[model samples]
Target: MEMQKEPVGDLQLHQVLRMNEGDGDNSYSNNSLLQKKVILKAKPILQETIVQLYSKSFPECITMADMGCSSGPNTFLPIWEVLEAIDESSRKLNRKPPILQVFLNDLPGNDFNSIFRSLPSFHKKLEEEMGGEFGPCFIAAMPGNFYRRLFPPRSLHFVHSSYTLQWFSEVLEIPLNKGNIYLAKTSPPGVHKAYLNQYEKDFTAFLRSRSEEMIPGGCMVLTIYGRDENSDSSAKHSPTIWDFFGMMLNDMELEVTTPENHKLSM
Candidate 1:
């Protein structure tokens, strides 16, 4: 049987430019400039939360995975920070650091070259911090569609995905009509419904897959694009950088297609 072709959209294209720097030297710098502030502010909060949660359950869990770990040195920054926090916490409790199996996942087309280029530096950082006594840290790439299987059953102890789950394999388009007033606009009812439906399906699959591969008490830390605390369900657009990317995608001439629509379970 032939494998299904994964869907692509404006977000993927933008990522290509950001990762490949096809536009020129300044393209990535410009993009990073725009994202720097938000990245700095959010990294600590996300890192703290994931570390705290995982430490509470698996105080010595060394095996962890970062799904959708696109190519970038910055991508691993927060992950390492979280690991360091876990190490410190473990030492305080008089326990040896757990052996870490760091699995970095992404699409087959992702720029693994760049990721590999940064691996040595990451290892050196680990060596500098842990010296010879640091727990063994092994890094490997798991290339495939995350919507599908990515690891052996019941293998992972903790999982982390950031700003990635909001992106469905495809963007669902909502046609403008008399019944749908929010079509083509941000937070349009139709668009919101479409996005949520896709997210629900994908997220459920993600949870199920992880559940199978994760220990009963395994922890999952996901920082996704979401509506504001005060926003109602009627508001469709994410109140995060994803919203900006979505608008940019629309402007870049990418067509959004709505597949099967369904309600999502939180």
Candidate 2:
């Protein structure tokens, strides 16, 4: 897929960028096993946050939000983890479990219908495990970019996002960044500056939006891919996969290059 320079508000482009539906070859449901691993890796952090919240004050109702929840099996993992932590804490404290209100968020173009299809089984399992202990639970979908607010002010108690915020909401295009895409070694200084500026802009917006929505004792667990600051080579860091992709593109261009074509293309 070609990377677009457009921002997240480009709804038409978002529709194209969204994951494939069903369990097909390119479907997120089939391809998100790695995402599941990321969620698992962050489980301990999530548990600790929940424990802290329970220790501080056990609210009568818990409001949780999972951002960038791509439609798939991994979509429900955060909710399950939260429920487990809440259950354990409640048992240890000998207190009644709180009513739960969970919100699942993603871009408007996400496969929400596909996600909804799996809810029947999700609710069934939750009921079986949490019957008579916890109050009635409600789950709903909130569709939009996480760089902006989705919930009401002081409504959310916890927010979770796994391996998602590493992506900038949009890439700033520079004429100097001609052949290569996304911060290549050969890119000019301006390109690097532009990327950093965009990163700050988007991330700042994300944090500010969450701040408005979360309660006083709220907590958020975010998992993102960050490069080692001491590493000079961009290819050796977290974007190694993208580096390989750029190499493949360069190779394909070389294969099509010839004396006559080279002069014409230039």
Candidate 3:
């Protein structure tokens, strides 16, 4: 969707960018199988990083931020993985479990209320698994843009993002990519360049902001959906599922969009 350039009146990217949210049947919390799979694939990395960080610092409290944590079942998956890792590491080292301060971050538009309502069961499960012996863990909502700094300097111990960085901070018009939402066989050279340039700019901002927020020995685990540069950008062998979704979006655009109200709205 095309957006007006930055002026106060222009819609902010954070205001517009988000997954379907709520507790309904088709909401992100209910129908996020792909996102759940992403969390599983990154589980090993998250566990390893948690162990390493805990062993190195052994801080009384571990402050973790799950960036782009859209509200859903997948939002807390990393928390479980890391907690198990820390529990194991602590036992092996003869140390007590560290207290956890979990921050679930997303744009202001995310359905944090649904996540909040579901917290009791999550904490209950934690108690069921570790009993009262494990250090108390707390989860809080952090609403903001990841492209900007959201924490005090050197405050975060661990950071994680899954299928988040692929989205651009702003959805600008790419007139060159006619008939395609992304780079495809029919796309012109400029279309690919525009996408790559935007990705590089947004990623640089993310890294720079994160570097300041994370401590010296802090670690991060990130998983992105992407296609190989050399491979054909078709649905058959592509690693990402955007090809199918993009086609669906294009159809919707054609069906409903008009010259005056072309931009999509939820």
List model 3 lDDT by residue over 1-266, tens digit each. Answer: 43233433225656766778887888888888988987998798889889989999799999999998998788889889988998899999999999999999999988888888889999999999988899989999899889889999999999999998887777645545655556666667766787889899989999999999999999899999886877655545543365676678777887776654555544
User: Number of clashing residue pairs in every model?
Assistant: 4, 0, 0
- Give lDDT tens digits, candidate 2, residues 24-46: 88888998888899899889999
Q: Report the lDDT of model 2 for residue 25.
A: 87
Estimate every model's Cα lDDT from 0 to 1: 0.63, 0.82, 0.84
| lDDT by residue for model 1 (1-266), tens | 11123546655743442244323564332355433444456666756765566567654545778887766555675567666776776677677777777888877667677777778888898889877687777888887667767788988877877667766655454434222222223344655576568778988888888888876667677777565535553466444554555556554433333232222221
Candidate whose lDDT is highest: 3
- Model 2 — which ten-residue stretch has the worst lDDT? 1-10
TM-score against truth, every candidate = 0.69, 0.87, 0.86
- Shift of residue 208 alpha carbon in model 1, Å: 1.5
Off by over 4 Å in 1: 1-61, 171-173, 177-188, 229-266
In model 3, the clashing pairs are none
Candidate 3 regions exceeding 4 Å error are 1-11, 232-266
